[model samples]
Target: MSTAGTMLVIGATGTTGSRTTARLAAAGHRVKAASRRAAPVAGAEPVAFDWHDPATHAAALDGVDRVYLIPPLGDSDPAATMLPFLRKARDAGVHRAVLLSSSAIPEGGPAVGAVHQALPGLFGQWAVLRPSWFMQNFTGAHAHARSIRDEGIIRTATGSGRVAFVDAEDIAAVAVRALTDEQAPNTDLVLTGPEALSHDDIAALITEVTGRPVAHHHLSYEQMRDRLAQQLSAEFAAMLAGMDRAIAEGAEDRVTETVQRLTGRPPGTFRALLEREMPVLPSDPAVR
Candidate 1:
């Protein structure tokens, strides 16, 4: 709403958080970019913030009337830390809050769902953004991206399942509107890309666009979970594998207009994203 009080953005160094902070600052709104190191972010002030450390909460909340919340990464029960900080935030005069959530997780479902459930009651003006899988997963430092780069393979338990992978920039746009609009969405919004694509479709698209040999390797749920366990907690690995299984069951096999409706522009396509982020080989005649 009014650009009087500052906006506090947690996880300011993250995908959507960084973009949100930059957009806010570019629009001339005051922003406090919160990260563990309190690293400087362009166009915003840096502040140290840790979800588990309540001592970092008050300082981040000071002079902040609105907040963009990015829950602790890999925390299965984020509500434990987030709820407490949220209560403290409300007490410290924060009125509007926008929470980042996932499309697979419904309100009160599990993981960040618990925080989503508590948000409405905590702030009079609030919005919960439930976005689908990010398109950047295949281009950035995500495991999928690593595998694609190293082995030219994308492994997953989701066999033939499709996802409407939205862009992090689109999610950030929606977050900005939710945080700055006079009237918050006041409801959970499920954001998705314009089309639903299976992992096989993604692999083919990457191969064609980048002129690289890429393939999707289907794995059993147990296989995927055990592989992920090497890098993540057993519980978290299981949860991620379960999500893949759900995708295989057609849980995420749909697209939505949420991004366009909120941002007044179309969501980005996977092909477009790949072309923009990946270099096309000179040997590929399609682009040459």
Candidate 2:
């Protein structure tokens, strides 16, 4: 007998993907948490899944009625890289596919948005999560977090511009709904925090929440690029610094109500997110 709605979560170990996996399983859905490593998850089946390999696609799609598309890393165009996988998912009986995309990158960009473009023709249903820069970027072992904790300074080309900085957990909540429910709007969901806050505001928030003397350290676009180049490739450094430049230009300084509409509750406030995640961040005062 075929399961009517077997949900498959791609990139099951990632931040949002892992949360979605747990949420779906808790709902009593038969979830197949797929990954290249197939890490174990309670109340769900772990299956082998690799975006680059076509031969293993069918194995992951077995009994999968819906899919959460988290594309492989690197700069390759996902529209092309993951198309065959999407096609195979459809052929193997997957109905809907929810894609994780970026808020900074506009629709039809060279990467995730490409998957956003291709999924409609390749599947029965689709939804794209166009979320802003994550709050987790500051709370996790990434550039933002390291800079704040180690240097007591945050460097960015984004001058004093604000961003809505949505939380990945919120993104997962929206994704879980789109995957299991029938009423998800078949379009992009621009998930954001309840309000936008400048990088200065962010530094202030941390100082207030943690009672630490943190500060926003701003730099010119060229200077920021040069500063980051020492840590990453010139090309990669430029790409990341360019995003800061965009934010400086007011590209991502706004709020939206989509999170509430889609997930049926207000998106987590930046303060709320900080409160929940503060205890988890490493206590070392010097980690830059």
Candidate 3:
């Protein structure tokens, strides 16, 4: 079997973390997943832990050698809350840490970037997964059903701005490799799809595949921010606005071979992902 000392995974129930946990467990590593909920996993131990609750942190850190770190949800100062837990991980003998970050957030700007600044001195091995906007966010989250049923619109500040949007599955695949196979990629990787497409391009793709007319609704940054403020915390609402502003400014329009370099295969194209998810989207009378 395979073992890499002991790997403790935070956010194991989340999108990338869940897949990474399964991959690590399948590789025969001694893996335990930490989350706020105490759900049983097939091949690993699930410990009840919360980023907000420091009391349960150490027990989860017990006997761990490497860690898969995920920053908590909105409103926590990553430097303050996450750094202490990272210090505890080091104290518990963890020498490697893999952090899941965003490409939208620059390496030293906010969120996981702050943790990136602090990891090298604390751990012997480390990599940060800086993935572009997730395709799953459109399909799995609050937007999917709404987008389909109404064939309404995807409102954004990214007007005609092309983004090489990537899949969470692809991100997970790369993260697994980073966690297991490679030397610390010790740098920010701008993960993206093979081709960059504008919001209208995405709408066109949906129209082609599903035969449904979905529109790209462009909004000014402040308008989107004000609308988001009604739904999210001030900080989180601001983050979305910031990311959209980045998209507007052409920060996410990258196309890279990093995925192929790391995984020995090309990143899945947006068309491929869209076709796979075509069933989940609404039907068009023209196609039907």
- TM values, all candidates: 0.96, 0.90, 0.91
Better of 2 and 3 by TM-score: 3
Pick by lDDT: 1 or 2, better one: 1
Residue range 47-76, candidate 2, lDDT tens digits: 988888777788788888888888786544
User: How accurate locally is residue 255 in candidate 2, as Cα lDDT from 0 to 100?
Assistant: 88
Better of 1 and 3 by TM-score: 1
Per-residue accuracy of model 3 over 35-79 as CA lDDT, tens digit each:
898567768889888887999988888888778887887752577
lDDT of each: 0.92, 0.82, 0.77
RMSD of 1: 2.8
CA lDDT of 243 in candidate 2?
86
Model 3 steric clash pairs: none
Instruction: Please give, for residues 1-288, the per-residue lDDT of candidate 1 as tens digits.
Output: 555479999999998999999999998899999999999999999999999899998899999999999999988889998998999999999999999999999999888999999998999999999999999999988999988877788999999999999989999999999998878899999999999999999999998998877889999999999999998899889999999999999999999888899889999998889989887744423321
Cα lDDT for residue 226, candidate 1? 100
Taking every candidate in turn, the Cα RMSD to the unseen true structure, in Å, is 2.8, 3.0, 2.7
Could you tell me the TM-score of candidate 3? 0.91
Against the hidden true structure, what lDDT does model 1 obtain?
A: 0.92
Best model number under lDDT: 1
Error of 1 at 208 (Å): 0.8
lDDT of 1 at 93: 97
Q: How many backbone clashes does candidate 1 have?
A: 0
